[model samples]
Target: MPTTKKESLQFGLMMCFGMVLFMTIYNLFLSGFIEAITLMEVIKEFIIGFLIALTLDIFLVGPGVKKIVSKLPIDKSKKINMVLAMSTLMVLAMALFMSVFGLAISYLHNGNEDNSLLKDYFSTFLKNFIVAYPLQLIVMGPLVRYLFIKFVLKIKCNCNEY
Candidate 1:
C-alpha cells in the first residue's frame, strides 16, 4: 500500500496511534478502571505505549510481518490477499510483543508476588490478541488506509472534485 518511505512512516504512525489509544483504554477497562479512568491517565499511558509500540512496529514487527507474508503461498498479485496477510500477521505480532511489554510494566509497578508471571503473560497475550485482531482487521486497518489516502496522499474523489 505504501510505495514510499514517507508514506510507510505515516501509515505506521497512524496505525500505532489508533491501536495504542484503543488498546490502552481496553486494557484499563479490563483492569477494572472503568469508572476511575481519567483523561490524563489515558494520555500518559498512551504516550508511553505509543512510543514502545511504534518502535517495535518499525524495527521488528513490520519487517518480520512483511517477510512472513512474502513467504506465504497467497497470490501476491491480488492486493486484497497481500493486505489481508500483512494485516493479520502484523496484528498478531504486535499483540504478542506488546503483551510482553504490558506485563513487564505491570510487574514493575505492582510486583508479581503470586509467581504467576508466565500465566499472566499468556492470559494477557490471548486477551489482547482476541480484541486486537478484530480491531485491526475490521476497524483500524480500513480506517487508516482511507485516512492515509485521503489526507496524506491528498487524493480527491471524482464525484467531489469540481
Candidate 2:
C-alpha cells in the first residue's frame, strides 16, 4: 500500500506499534501473567517488544515478504491478490521470528528450569501464529491502511474543500 520509502516506513511503524501491543497483551494473558502484570511492567515490555518487532519487520521480514510475494503465482494486477499474499507471508515470517524473541524474553524473565526449549519454542510459535495471522489480516492490516490514508495522505472530502 505504501508507494514511497517514507510511506513504507510510516506504515511499518504503525503496523509494528499495533501488532506488538496486541501480541504482548495476548501473550501475557495466555501465559496467565495478566492477573499479576502491572501497567509499568506492561509498558516496559511493550517498549522492548516494539523495538525488536519494528527492527525485524523493517529490516528482515518486510523485504523478504516483498521478494516472496513477487514470486508467488497470484495475479499481481489485482491489488487485493498482492495485498493478501504479502500480508499472509509477512504474518507468517514475523510470527516465526518474533516467537523466538518471545521465548527468549520468557526464559530471561522466568528461567527455563524444565529444559524444554525446543518444545516451548514450537508451542510459542504456534500460539503466536494462530493469533497473529487473523489479527493482521482482519484487523491491523485494514486499520493501519485506513489510518494511513486518513492521516498520512490527508485525503479530505471534496465537500469540505469549498
Specify the highest-lDDT model's number.
2
RMSD of each: 3.2, 2.7
- Compare the candidates by TM-score and give the number of the best one: 2
Task: Score every model by TM-score.
Answer: 0.89, 0.91
lDDT of 2 by residue, 1-162 (tens): 788888899999999999999999998888777777688988998999899989988899999889888888889999899879988898889898999888987787678979788999999999999999999999999999999988877743444678
In candidate 1, which residue pairs get closer than 3 Å at backbone N, Cα or C atoms, i.e. clash?
none
Q: Report lDDT (Cα) of residue 140, candidate 1.
A: 97
Q: Each candidate: what lDDT?
A: 0.86, 0.89
TM-score of 2: 0.91
Per-residue alpha-carbon lDDT of candidate 1 for residues 1-162, written as tens digits (9 for 90 to 100) = 888777888999999999998998888778666466577866877899999999988899998998889899999999899989998898888888899877875676567879787899999899999999999989999999999888877753444676
